[model samples]
Target: MQIQDLPYPDPGVPDVRSGSRFLWWLGRNQLGGQIRSMAWGLLHFTAVSAQPFCVGYAVQAVVDRSGTRLALAGGLMALCCVGIAVGDTFLHRAAVTNWITAAARVQQLLARKATQLGSALTRRVAAGEVVAVSTGDVEKIGWFVEAVSRFTAAALTVVLVCVGLVVYQPALGLVVAVGLPVLALAALPLLPRATRRADLQRQKAGRATELASDTVAGLRVLRGIGGEDLFLDRYRRASQDVRHAAVRSARMWSLISAIQVLLPGLLLIAVVWYGVQLAREGRISVGELVTVYSSVMVLTYPLRHFEEIAMAYSFSRPSARRAAGVLSLERSTDTEGSRPADVPSGDLYDPDTGLFAPVGRLTAVVCGDPDAAGRLAERLGGHPAEAGTTSVLLGGVPLDELPLDAARAAVLVQDKDPVLLSGTLRELLDVPASGDVEPRAALAAAQCEDVLEALVQGSLDAEDPLDARITERGRSLSGGQRQRLALARSLITDPEVLVLDEPTSAVDSHTEARIAEGVSRLRTGRTTVVFTSSPLLLDRADRVVLVHEGEVAAVGEHRELVLTEPRYRAVVTRETQDEPASATGPETPSEAAPITAAGTAGATEADDDGAFRGALEEIEETA
Candidate 1:
C-alpha cells in the first residue's frame, strides 16, 4: 500500500513465528514497493558507475588529441550527469516511500493488536515495551526494509563495474576485482560482536523505558509516599546501564566502520600503485591508469552499502522480535474455533462462583476481597483468568465460545479504575452504542456537570466543555472526575449487559447516591451487574448477592440481608461485632423497632456514612 493510503484497512495477519520470519513477512507483503525501489536504485547506481567510464574515455580522447572523439566524450559525460540527477531524485523518492509505508503498516498492526487485546495487552507485555515497539522500533524496522533494496542495487553495480573493467583492461581489472572482495569481507569478523553489543543495548534501553513509564504513571503516588527519591535513583541507574550498553555498541560499530574505511583505502592504494607501475612500463596508458584509480574510488562508495545493510539488520532484528512478541499475544477469549454467539436472553452466570445476574435486572455483588470482586467482574464479561477454562455462560452458552466482538457487545465491564482516554469530551463519549442514551444524559446521570464546568474553567480559550481537550489518560482531571467521565462513556454504550466494579468508589456519599439512582433510572430495562459494598449502590440494586470466599453466600434485598445475615453485614458494613442474626425467621421487634423509631434509622445511617467515608479516605490514601 502507498504511504498516502496509510492505516491499511487490514494490516494483514502477521506471521509472528519469529523475529526473522516476521521481518521476512513484512518484506514479502511490500514486494511491489521493494521492486520499485530496487529499479530506481539500479538506475541511480548504474548512472554513477558510468560516470567513471565517461571520465576515462574523456582522458583517453584528450591524450589522443582527437577533436571528434573528445567532443563525443564530453557529450556522453553531460548525458551521464543528467542521468545521475534524474535517477538520484526518483531513487530517493521511491526509497522514502518504502520506508514510510513499511513503518505505517507496522504501526497499524500494533494498534490493531492493542485494540484486540485491550487490558490484557499490558498484562502480557510491558507498557514500556509496547511504547518502544510502536515508536523507535517501527522506524528501525522500516530502515532495514528500505536498506535491502538499495544494498541489492549497490552490490549488483559493483559486480557489473568489476566485469566491465576486466573486459576493458585485464591487468588493472584483475587487481581491482580481487581486491574489492577482500575489502568487503574485512568487516565480517567484527559484525558478530557488533550485533551482540547492539542487542544488549536494545535490551537495556527497553528496561529503562519501562522503568521510566512506571515512574511517570505513579509519580503522584511516589510523591505522596516520599518514595520519589527512591524511584528516581532506580531510574538513574537504569539510564546509566543503558548508556554504558549504548557506548559499547557504538564502539564496536565504530571499529567496523574504521575497518571498512581502512581496507577500502588500502585497496585504492594498491590499485593506484599497480596501475602506475603498468603505465611506467608502457603496458597501460595514462588514460587507463586514471580510469582504474577512479573506478576503485567509485567502487568504495557502493562498498559502504555492505556495512550499512549489516548495521541496519543488526539493529532491526531485535526490534522485529519485540514487535512480533506483542503481535503474538492472544486474549483469553481468543480461540481458533470461536464463532459468533447470539446475545443471550437469559441470566449472566458465572459457573465457577455460582453467581448469576438475572436478565433485565440490576444485580449488586458484594465480596469481602476487592481482588476477587474484580476477577468476577472480568469473568462476567468473558475475560477469565485463563484461556479455555472459563465457564461463564450466557443463555446456557459459554461466553468464551463467542467471538470477541460479540462477547464484548453482549457484556460491557468497567473495572474499578477505568481509564479515560485523551480527547475532546465529545470524542471520548463517541463510542459504539445502541443510540438509546445521549451523551448529555449519560454525563448528567454520572454527575459529570461539575467535571464539565472544571474543564471549561481550566480551558485557556474558555471553550465549551465538550470541546476542551483532555490530557493523556485524563491526567489533568481528578480521580473522581475521571471515574465519572468513564462511567458516562460506558453508559452511552448501552450494551446488553453492563458490569461495573465499584463504579462510584472515588466519589463522596452524596454523589454516589445520586449516581446510583441516575444509573438505575438510565438503565431501566437493560441488565446491569454492579460489584460493590457501598450501601448507597447496594440499596439501589433490585437484587443483592453476597459472595463470601468466592461463592454466593446469600441472595436477598440489601436491608434484609443486612439484618438477617451476619456475614453480609460484616462484609458490607465492616462491622466487627459477631452477634448472631436470625437467618430463616422474621426479625423480632427489638431488631426491627429501631427502623420505625423516629430519627433512629437516620442515626444508624449517619454512622454507616461515617464508616464509609473513613473507608474511602483510607483507599484514597493507599492509592
Candidate 2:
C-alpha cells in the first residue's frame, strides 16, 4: 500500500483514533492485503498439519515392510517438505506486507491529527510523546496487528493436528487434545500482571521521551541561564526512572516466557509417556506411536506461537492506549451561534473575560505578561480554549461560534516565533496557494529590502530572496530575519483580522520602524491587532488595551496609555523588566510588563544585568 493510503491524519482527515480500534482499522484499510495474507496463511497451516500426518503414515509403512509402500511414504515426506518450503516462503512474504501497511496507516493517522489540532496540539501534548508515537508507537501497534493473523493460523494448525491424532489413535488423541488447551491457558493468569507492568513502563518511557525533547528544545535558553547542568541532571534522573520501569516490565515478560517453555515441556513429556504406554498395551502400533509423537512435537511450535501472541498483546496494549489517548484529546469546541462571513468585521468580544477588541482598526493589547498576550491571541482566533479559552466575539458573534475554516480564513493569528518551513522564500510566502507577492511591494511592506539585497548578493535567490531557498525552519536566516519572513507570510495572506503577537520582538529599531509602518499601510482599512510592549508597534495602533490580572485594565492610544497607565509604561519601556528574579516554571507568578516607558526598541537584557535593570523591575513590581 502507498504511504498516503494509510488511514492517517491529513488536511482532510483529522487524526481521531480511540484505541485498538485504530490499529484494527488499519488492517481494514488494506483488506486486500489482509485477505491475501490470511489465505496464504491458511494454506501454509494446512501444509504444516499434513507434515505430522505424513510422518505417522510413513512410520506405519516402514513397519509393514511393504517396499513399494515405503517408497511411496518417503515420496510423500518429500512432498510435504516442498509444501513447507513454498508455504513458509509465501506466508512470510505476505506477513511482512501486512506489518508494513499497518504501521503506515498508524503514521498517517498521527500526521493527520497533528494537522487537525494545529497550534493547539503543541500546547497540550509534549513534543517527546508526539515523537515517540509517530516513530516507536506506530511500529509496536503494527507488530501486534501482523502477529494476530499468524497466531490465528498457528492456532488453527494446532487444532487440526490434535483432531487428526484423536481420530487416528483414540487414546493418544484424547491426551493431545486436552494438552493443547492446558498450554494455551498457561499464560492467562499471568497476562494481567504482565500487562500492568508493561503499561507503566510505556507511560514512563513516553514521559522520559518528553523530558529529553524539552531539554533539547530549551537547550539554548537553558545555556543562557546557566541551567544546562541542572536540566542535564534532571534528564539523567528521568532516564534512570525509565530504565527501572523497563527492567520491571522485562522481568514480568521473562517470567511469562519461562512459564511458556515449562508448560510446553510438561505437555511434551505427558504426550510421550502416554503414547509409550499405549504401545506397550498394543493399543497403538510402533508406526502409529511415531506419527503421534511427531504430530505432538509439531503442535509444540504453534503452542509456542500462542504464548508469543499473548506476550505481544500484553506489551503493545499499553502503547496502543497511549496513542489512543492522544487521538482522543478534546479539540477546540465551537459554541452554538454561527458567525457570518460578511458580518462586517467589527468589535471582537471575549465573553468569558469580558474583553472586547473593536474592529476595522489597529488595536494593541498590552498584557503585563507576554504569555497572557499569547493566550488572548488564541481566543481571538476562535481557537478552542478551556472554559475561559478566550471567547472573543466578531461583529456581535463569538469567534468560537464561527466554523473553524471560515474563522481561520477571516482572522489570522501570527504567533510569536511562528514556525518557518523549509523552501524558497516565495515558496514559503504562498503557503496556501501558488502565491507570489510582487517582490518590491512585499519587500517594502515587510521592510525586507535589506534582507532581499543580502539574499540576491549572496545568490540565495537567482530569482530573488523571496524566491531563494530557505532551509528547514529557515535555520540559514538570522532570528530576526526568520521573524520578518513569517510576518511577510502573514501579510501576504491579507486576512481581515490580523492578530500578531510580539511581531517585532526580534528585529532592530530601523527594521522594526519599517515593519510597523509597512504593517499599518498594508493592513489599512482592515482589523489589525498587535500584541506588543514595543512603543513602535504601540504608537502606530489606533487604540491600545492594557490587560492586568487577566482583565483589561486600561484602553487608549500609546501616548494616552503612557500618561494614564503606570503599569503599561513599565512594560512598554525597559522600565520594569522583572521576570521572577530567577527561574520559575509555568506555575510561578510572573510580573507583567508595566506602563509604557520612553525608549525605542532593544532585546530583553533583564536576565543578564539584573542590577542595571533593577529600577525597571521595581516599577513593574510596584504596579
Candidate 3:
C-alpha cells in the first residue's frame, strides 16, 4: 500500500517496492522535480564523460605528431573542464531540491499521524520519544528520502559511463565495467554489522533523550527532595552510554569507509595498469588508454554513492522502524450517530466500583484512591476503559462500547490539570459544546473574577466571549488559577454528565466555597460526579459516595456521614472532631454554610426543585 493508505499519513512507509521501488514511489510523487534533477544528473554525466574522450584525443594528437590537432585537443580539454565544473554545480543544486521535497512529504505524513493518535500517543509511546521523532527522527527520515534520488542518478551515471567505455575500446571498457561491480560490492558484507551498531546507537540516544526529558519535567520536585544529584548522576551515565554507543557505531562505519576508499583507489590503479599494458601490446591507441583511465576514475564517484547509500539506509532503518511503531498504534474511530448505552436516561454508572450516581442527581464520589477516581473519570468519558478494572455504563450501553466521540459529547471529564490551549480567556471557556454556558456565569461559578481581571480586556474584543490569550497549557498562571480556568472550561461545555476530579484542590477555601455554590447552583437536574475530599465541595453534593479500597464503602449526606463514619469525617474534616476552643481552630468559611456538612449537602428537593432557576436567574442578572 502507498504511504497514504497506512493507518495514518507518514510517507516513509516501505511500499510494494523495496529500496529503488520505494524511491520510485517518491519519484512518482514529485515526477516534475525528479525529472529536473535527472536532467541535471545527465548533464553532469555528459560533461564528465567528455573529459576522457578529450584526453584520449589529445594523446592521439601527440602520437600523430600533429601540432594543430594537439592544440585543438587542448582547447576541447578546456571546454570539457568548464562543462564538468558547471554540470557539477547544477547537479548538486538539483539534487538538494530532490532531497528537500522528499523530506517534506515524509514530514507531512508524520504530522498527520501525530494528530490522529492525539492523547493516546503518550499512553502508547514515551513523551520524549515523540519529542525526538518530531525533532530529530523526522529529519533523518527526510535525509533517507532525499538520498534515494541522488543514488538513483549516480547509479545511472555509472551504468552509462561503463557502457561507453566498453563500446569505445572493447578490452579496456570490459576492465572498467567489470571492476565497477567489485567496488560497489565491497561495502555489502559490512552492512548488517553496521546496521546493528547503528540501531544500538540510536536506542542509546533515545534513552539519553528520555532521561533528559524526565529530569527537566521533575526538576522542581527533584530539587525539593534533594534528588537532583541522583537524577544528575543518572543523566550523566545515560549521556556517557550514548556517547560510547555512538563511538562503537562510528568505528564500524569508519572501517567500512576506509575499505570503501581503499578498494576503489586500488581498483583505479588496477584498471590503469591493465590499460597501460593493453596500449603497449597495440590492442589500444594512446588516446584510448587515456579515455579508459579517465572513465574508470570518474566512475569512482557514482560507485561511491552505491556504498554511501547503503550506509545511509542502514542508519535510517532504525528511524523508520520507530516512526512506523508510532504510526502502527491503533486509534479508535467513532462511528456516526451513536450514543452511549447503559446510561439510563441520565444516570452515570461506574462499572468498576458498581457505583451509581442516580439519574439527574448531584453525586459526589470521594475516592481515597486518586488513581481510581481518575480512571473512573476516563471510564465515564467513554475513553478506552481498561478491561475488568475501568468501565462505566450509561443506560444499557457500556461506555467503551459507544463510539468515542459520541460518548465524549455526552459525558465530559475535566481533568484537574486540563491544558488551556493558547487563545483568549473567552476561548478558554468556549468549549466543544460550542460554549453552551454563558461566559459571565461560568466565570462566576468557577470564581474566576481574578483570572478574568488578569486577562487582557476580558476577551471582549471577539464576538465570542471565550477568546483570551492563554499561553501554552496556561503556564502564565499559577497552578490554582489554571485549575479554576480549566474548571470553567468544563462547566461551559455543560455535557449531560460532568465528571470532575479534584477540580477545587488548587483553589483557596473562599474560591472553593464559591465554586461549590456556583456549580451546585448551575448543574441542577443534570448528572454531576465530583471526586474530592474538600468538605466544601462534598457538602454541596446531593450525596457523597466514599470510595475505599477501590470500591464504594459509604454513601450519605456529608453531615450525617461526618458525624457517623469516622473515616469519612477524617477524610473530609481531616480530624475526628471540631476544636473545643471557640478558636474552633480558626472558624472555617464552611461553618455557617448550609450543606456545610459535605460543604454542599445543599442538595435538597427544594434546591434542585428550582433546577433551572440558576440559569434563569443568571440570564436576568447578567441582562
Candidate 1 lDDT over residue span 258-335, tens digit each: 998898888888888888889999999888888888888888888889999999999999999989989988765564
Better of 2 and 3 by TM-score: 2
lDDT of each: 0.84, 0.73, 0.71
Ordered list by lDDT, greatest first: 1, 2, 3
Q: Best lDDT goes to which candidate?
A: 1
lDDT of 3 by residue, 398-456 (tens): 66566556677778888655777887776565557645578687778888878766665
Deviation from native of the Cα of residue 341 in model 2, angstroms: 7.7
Q: Candidate 3: where are CA atoms >4 Å away? A: 1-51, 54-120, 331-345, 358-361, 389-391, 395-398, 420-431, 438-444, 447-477, 492-494, 521-527, 573-623
Instruction: Please give the lDDT score at residue 407 for candidate 2.
Output: 75
What local lDDT does model 2 show for residue 600?
23
Q: How many angstroms is residue 449 displaced in model 3 relative to the true structure, after the best TM-score fit?
A: 5.0
Ranked by TM-score, top first? 1, 2, 3
**155-197, model 2: which lDDT tens digit per residue?**
7777777788788888888988897898788879988988888
